[model samples]
Every structure is written in C-alpha cells, then in structure tokens.
Target: MDAMIPLAQFLWLAGALLAAGLATGILAGLFGIGGGAIIVPVLFEVFAAVGVAPELRMHLAVGTSLAIIIPTALRSYAAHRARSAVRADALRRWALPVVLGVVAGTALASVSPDRVLKFAFVAFAALMSGRLLFGRDHWTLGEQLPGRALMSAYGFGVGLSSPLIGISGGGIASVIMTLYRVPIHQAIATSAGLGVLIAIPGALGYVLGGWPHMAELPPLSLGYVSVPGAVLVGSVATLAAPLGARLAHAFTKRQLEVAFGLYLLIVGARFAWQLVA
Candidate 1:
C-alpha cells in the first residue's frame, strides 16, 4: 500500500501525475532517465502535501512511480524499436542478470527505511545526472562495448539501483553504454528497452511486497501503486513517449547532452533545496 490522501488531494495528485508522466516519458525517451529523476522528487512533494507520513513518503513515491512507468516505457521501447535504434544483442545478453537484479532491488527496498531511500534517490540522481552532463566529451572504458560478463554486471547494477530510486535503469545504462563507445542514440534506445525491463518486474515487485500495508494506502491502491494514478499518468505518458522518440531523432548528441545536463542541474538544485528544508 502507498500513501493515503483525501479526495481533494487525490485530484491534485492525479493532475500532477499526468503532467509528470508527460514530461517524464519524453525525458525518458530523449535522455534515458526512465522518468524517475523527475517523478521521484515531484511525488515526494505531492505526497508530502497530501499528508503522507514523512517516513513513508519516499517508499510510496518510488513504488507508485514504478507503476506508472510500465506503459510509458513500453511506448518508448516500441518507438525505439521501430527506428531500429535498440542494441538487441546487448539487451539479450543483459536480460537475465537484470531481472535478477530487479528482484534484489525490490527486496532491499521492502526492508529499507524511508529516509535512506529518499537520500539514496537524491544521491543517485545527482551522480547519474552529473555523469551525463559533465563527464568527458568522449570517454571510453574500452574501445568497444564491454564483454558479456562485464555488460551483465553493468546491467545488474542498473537494475538493482534503478528501482531503489524509482527509475527504469536507463539513466545508468545509457551512461555506461555511451562511455563504452556505443552510439549515443543506440544507447538511448536500448535504455528505453531496459526501461521496459525495469518497469514490468519492478512494478510487480512493489505491488507484491507492499500489499500488506493497506491501512496506510489510499483507496484503490494495489500495494504501493494508486491504480487511478497509474491509469491517469500512463495514458498521457504512453502517448507522449513516441513523440519524444521522434523528437530525439531531430537533435544532435551534443545538443541532447546539453539539454539533459541543464535538466539535471535543475533537478539537483531542487534536491539541494530539499536537503536543507
């Protein structure tokens, strides 16, 4: 179960969720953020305003964000596949480990304290965003993509940390692949695919693990997910995602990176403010 809110709060949260979904989906397609970098902080604020307990706010936010990501990720994945931008071989190689990692992440989140998860989300977001925005213009750990074993480890880490912060593992994946000399577009597209991987299992994990907390949840919630929230947000996000993929095609990598960096800077500033607040 997730947070509980009055009808008025519910209405406000739903509206915000839809907007967040729209923006998050587009950002996901364009920058491999899986929408959580945006959604997580926004959800925290929304839930806080709605009177969710301080200690439970981050958990509910992460769980609910994962729920909404399902359709958004799928739409982005389809769009990328249509463009043939995804690196299928890498996805295939990384799939198993990634799934295992999702389970691990969810299990840990189930037991994790709220503040820990919140700051983890903040720190992780800052790290990945900073990496994308400020890392060397042309950096490579290897001349080519890493070997299967190494890639598997990378995927595992992405999956493990992604759900912890309410993401699709895409941000980390894109950074790793791009740094390893993968084309930025291909890295982004494959990260969309990876987003799907993270969303599906990650959502289910949240649902199952969180089911017992019904007393704390809003009406119609399934585990930490507000079903209404998912439907409202997912609808717009699903629609917007393909459009984002299309838009992404129009931008040069440098331009995209600059835009993404600016976006992260804004997000980081918000987190910094929250830390002090």
Candidate 2:
C-alpha cells in the first residue's frame, strides 16, 4: 500500500508533516530547544521516502530543517517577548558577534567535507549530553568573563556549528547561558532570539552553497530548502509554539530541565547511531 502512493502526494504528506511539526514545535517552545532535534530525523525519513540520494539526504534534512526554523524561532521569540522573558539588552549585546559568527560559520560549511560535518554534530550532541547529565548540580561561576569578548567567542562557535547539524543554536545558547548563571526564563528567551541570528546566515549559506548542484535535486526545491515541506511544517509549528510556552509556565524549572535533558539524550543517541550506520 505504501509503495503504491505517489511520492509527490502533497496533501497527505503535508497533513502528516503538519501534525508531526506541531508536536515537535510545542516541545521546542516549552523546552527552549531548536526543533531540529525532532525535525532532522523525520525529514531524513521523509526525504528517503521521496527518493532523495543517500549522500545528499543529511544535507537536505539539515537545510530544510534550518529553513523552517527561521520563522518558527521568530514566532517563539515574539511569544516569549510578550511575557517579558526576552532580555532585549542581552540580545543587543550578543547580536553583532552572533551574526558575524553565523556568517563565518555558514561560509566555512560551504567548503567543509560532509563527513567532518557529521562527526562534528555527533561530538556536539555527546558533549551536550555529558554536560547536562554530570554538571546539572554545578553552579555557574557567574563572575562575568570579559563580557562581550567571551560572548562573541561562544556565539561564533555556536553559529559555526548549528546550521551544519540542522539546529537553531538553542541548545548551545541554553548551555552557555546556564553556565553563566542566567535565569532559565531569560536563557530560553535569549536562545529563541539567537535563532533568528543563526537561521538567516545559515539558510543563505545553504542556498548559495547548494545552488550549483540544484539540477540534481527533487522538484519544487530551492537549492536545499524544500518549499512545500517548509510551508507545511512552519505553519503548524508557529501555531503550536505558543501553547508550549504556556505549558512551560505549568512545570517546575527543574522538572523541565530533566525532561528536556532526557529528550536530548534520546535524540542524540538516535543521531549517533545513524551516523555510525
């Protein structure tokens, strides 16, 4: 029955994608995570079902996921801002370096080998898990390490790495803010704001870098961004994200942290296995 369906059956696929996206979107908003943790795996399966090449599958998954995150992140930021969780002062302070870092990272990704990218993502996920598990009880020094210079360095590292893995830089942002003893609410809000910074250059890089190879892609694709898929997923995610923000208010901060940590562990394990295979 599955084999009989046409690959481009847009409506059915869109419905399924919308439902899945909504669920993940809510999780993203509530947990202050980039939806990439869920989106990448699902997108990989979706692209495979549509016959995307094995070699290009990860690239497409990452690109499309990042593309959708742009708007989703913006919507999440707005929602958080409404609650006064977004610290505009901090965002302003970090913006320049984060944007610059994203541009540099995106440019670098264009020239880097795919294997290196994959390995880097796996390593990142592992490191994140280790930090969360073992360092949960550790308090941040909170002494402020050279202010803007330190932030720029962290921002650059996050910008350079997130797009390559199809994320919105939220995970890294959360960790950095946590280590600096930023309040959880403020950390989440700041991370959402950073998503916009990350997505812009990352999306541009994917489009430009992958353009020459366009002829090899599936129909209706703009470089690596799958327009139809992005539309379907982004729409639902926007609507669902606000609900997640509401849910966040219902849970204790510590509980939310544990839940989010476990979620990352599962997703990280899945991606690691995929990379290994």
Candidate 3:
C-alpha cells in the first residue's frame, strides 16, 4: 500500500504510461496489431529510466505489456465478433498449437537475456514491417489456407514469437492470414481472438515464473506485473479502442498497413540503438 505513494509522486512516469496506453489502444483498434509493439518499447524506456536492473527490466516490460493486452484484446475480440468478422474454424484449428507455443515462448522469456531478446524483437519486427510496407496481397504460397498441420505450424511460430516481444500474436497471425487469402477484415478479427490466447498464458507465465523475484521490480508490481501501470494503461486503452475500430473502417487497408509498418520500424530502430549504445 505504501509503495504506491512513490508511483503517484512520479508524475512523469505516470503521465507517460497513460499516454502510451492511449496511443497503443488506438493503434490496437486501428491495426489489430496488439499495441504491444508500441507498449514494449515504451515500458522498456520507462523501466530503464526508473533504474530497474537490466536483467529483469525487459521481463517486466514484456510482462506488464502482456497484462495490458488482456483487456484490450478481449475488447477488440468482442467488437469484431459482433461484426461477424471472426473466423472460428481457423481459430479452432490453430488455438491448441498456438497455446503450446505460448508456453514454450514464455519459458524462453523467463530465462533469456535482455539484449538477446531485444535483438530478436528488432529483427522480427523489421521483417514484419517490411512485409507490410512492400509485400503484395497476391503474393501467396498457396491458393487457399494451408492444411491443419501447416496452419498449426504457423500458429506455433506466432505464439512463440509474440511472447518474446510482449505482443498478443495478432500482428504475425494477421500477416500470415492475409497472405494466404484471408480477407483483411477477417484476418484482423481472427487475430483478435489469437491475441486473447496469447495474453492469458503469457501474463500468467510471467507472474508465476517471476514470483520469487517480485521484490526486485518497480513499485506497485506483483511479480513482473505492475498493477498501477497495467490498470492505468488498460483503462485508457479500452476507452480509445472503439475509436480506433471506428477509424479503421475509415482508412484503406494499405494505408493502415503502411502506418503499422513504419511504426514497427521505429520500434526496431529504438531497440537497435539501445543495443549498440
């Protein structure tokens, strides 16, 4: 209880977290991109600035970001479901495998070094961005979505990769879905469902794995999850998400992808700079 006073005193950090939530919430709605791409970078900087040790800083950032995704993803999922955009069949086939990957990825995140994870995030995000910026709709490997085995394999990759960078697995999932001829709207809707799967296990894994080290984290934290940070961020994210959904219908798909791609490039560049500097 007493620990929270310090958080209130840190006006800049509070404000920054709130602002980051607002932006990411809008982005989550606008791009169906999970907003973790932005939140991970923002929280990393905040934790660094607050003097968290390098060892656990990235974990905290990622864990807290996952926590934030819970509400945001569920909200987006419900909204998309109402629109009948969700493809339940594809999700049914991929959910189990993606869950498996989520478990494995969470295990990896619990042990890997910050620099190694950041580098991986940078590389993966850059590739995702490149595909968005330049990849064409018709460039697909097959005429239709893959068989169950192959689809599960791709889901595994998304589940594994997303936790490493604190995302909800939506970005990669949507990209793959769209590439294989899933309509962009359906892809976005399906990814929202995927995000829910990613966030639940991802958040629990961080909390359970890091419980022993909870005391080392920043104020208002439970294990790796920052209570106040997640609450503030989640609140704003939930409020702004509907606005983004409405706005999503206003823009061309290409325009949204381009913006998302540029944003990810910036995220990658920030981490790369941090790595070298």
Candidate 4:
C-alpha cells in the first residue's frame, strides 16, 4: 500500500490514521467504546481520499475498524480488569450468542446494500448518544439483569448491530447494562470485554464475507479489511488503551457520560451530513 501511494500522500494519511488511533484508544478505555464510532467516519474519509469507490467505502471502513479493535479491545479489557471493573458472569453468558450474531450480521452485510450499513451506523450512534446524554438514573429496565433467554437476545442484538455499525459491541452492550441498573463504570469495563468477543469474530467474518469482492478493494486488502488501515490504527490504539483506562477511573460518572455523549453526537452528526449531502 505504501509503495503505491506517493511519499507525501502516504505520510499525510499515516499521520491522520495515527491521530485517529490515539483518540480511538482513549475513547475505548475511557468510555468502554470500541471506538468504531470514531474510526468509521475517519476511515470513511481516508478511504474516499484513497479512491475507494463510494459504494464500497463504508464496508471497507467497517471491516477495517473491526480488525483494529481486536488489539485495542484486549488491551482495554486488561486495563479495566486490573481495576476489577469487568462483569465476568455477564461476559460468559454473552459469549456464544454474540459470536453467532456477528456471523449472522456479517452474512447480512455481504448481501445488504451500503445504505443499509450507513443508515445503521447513523441510527445506532444517534440512539446511543440520546441514551447517554439525556438518560437518568431512574431508567432501569429491571432491578436485576434479565433471564438467560433475554440476556442471550440482548447479546445477539449487540453482536448483530456491532458489525453493521463498525463497533466492538461496546456501545449497545454498555447501554443495555446501564438499563439493567449496572453501575456506569462497571458497565463500561464489561463492555470493553464484550468488545473482544465482538471484534475477533466480527473482523474474521468481514474478511470471509467480503472474499467475493476482493478484486474491488484497495491494494493489500484481505477481503474488506485493509491491512494498512488495521496496522496503522490498531498498533497505536493498542499502546494508548491502558492510558485511557487509567484516565477513566479519574472522572466522575456524570462527566464521563457527558463527554461520551458529546463525542457520539459529533460522530452521528458527521455521518448524518454525509447521508444528506
């Protein structure tokens, strides 16, 4: 990929991707997001600048983001685990269903129109922003988490939506945990763990699902996943993840919520603009 790009242009894109990685890592650890909300939009523009077709850019961005999340999510989860913040039991229950969901969603994406994915990204980001920004503590779905069947359903939903939106399942999982009355910090940490589950399979699924389209992708591509995009962003993001986790413990719950909400709002707005324009 670097061989094909002119030195100046390659340097420019590398800097942009590295910068995005820094922010993505921080957001991952700080807010327990997979940072796909950040990566997708940034990569979308990057892919466009690189001459990726309009119809293929979103899928490529999404597939690449999931690949990047693999390492970042693991590092973030480890950092949060050191603080004893993860909900291990919930992760165990969600494991199978979430993987299955990723498989299902990846299959769907292979056949679905690009608009379907772009719309999903916009809608999920908006819904998450609304929940974080305006939701009150009284917004409990129940006193405790639901039964296995319901829990599985939630996990499946997280899995299904995550690949579509290019996230690691953190956004939806954290929201669901909070709705079940889990502490925000714990929910965030657990979501980091859930990200591992979402990212690995999601990335793999995208690669396989996109096999038929390999010829349409940019150079050094593996199916929909861009080798350069993953390496450039994932490497920096992994190193920065621990720092974000440490910072996460320093902020008050409301402060964290507000920051995450505002960030999501900006991302959502950016995509909405793209759709309208």
Instruction: Using TM-score, give the best candidate's number.
Output: 3
**Candidate 4 residue lDDT tens string, 1-277:** 7665656555666776788778777777788555688789878888888777888999999999999888878988999999999988898899999989988998898788788898898798788889878988787888778989999999999999999988988878887888888887998899999899889988888898788888777766898898878998887777777899899999998899889888888877877877789
lDDT of 2 by residue, 1-277 (tens): 6754546455555666677678767886788564676677677777777667777767777788889888878888999999999877768877887788778776776676666556666677677766666665466857443377777788778877888787888877877887777787888888999999888778878888778778766656777777777787777777787889899998987777777767767766766777678
What digit string (tens of lDDT, one per residue) describes model 1 on residues 120-151?
77678578667757778666787778788898
* Model 3: lowest-lDDT 10 consecutive positions: 4-13
Clashing pairs in 3: none
The TM-scores of all predictions, comma-separated, are 0.82, 0.81, 0.87, 0.84
Task: Name the regions of candidate 3 deviating beyond 4 angstroms.
Answer: 1-13, 26-34, 240-256
Model 3, 3-26: lDDT tens digits are 775766456567777887787678
**TM-score of model 3 relative to the true fold?**
0.87
In terms of lDDT, model 3 sits at: 0.84
Task: Give, for candidate 1, the lowest lDDT window spanning 10 residues.
Answer: 1-10
Backbone collisions counted per model: 1, 0, 0, 0
What TM-score does model 2 achieve against the real structure?
0.81
lDDT of 1: 0.78
lDDT of 2: 0.75
Q: Comparing candidate 1 with candidate 2, which one achieves the higher TM-score?
A: 1
Model 2 residue 23 lDDT? 76
Q: Where is model 2 more than 4 Å wrong at Cα? A: 1-16, 26-34, 82-84, 238-259
- Taking every candidate in turn, the Cα RMSD to the unseen true structure, in Å, is 4.1, 3.8, 2.9, 3.4
Which lDDT value does model 1 have at 268? 62
**Local distance difference test values of all predictions, in order:** 0.78, 0.75, 0.84, 0.85
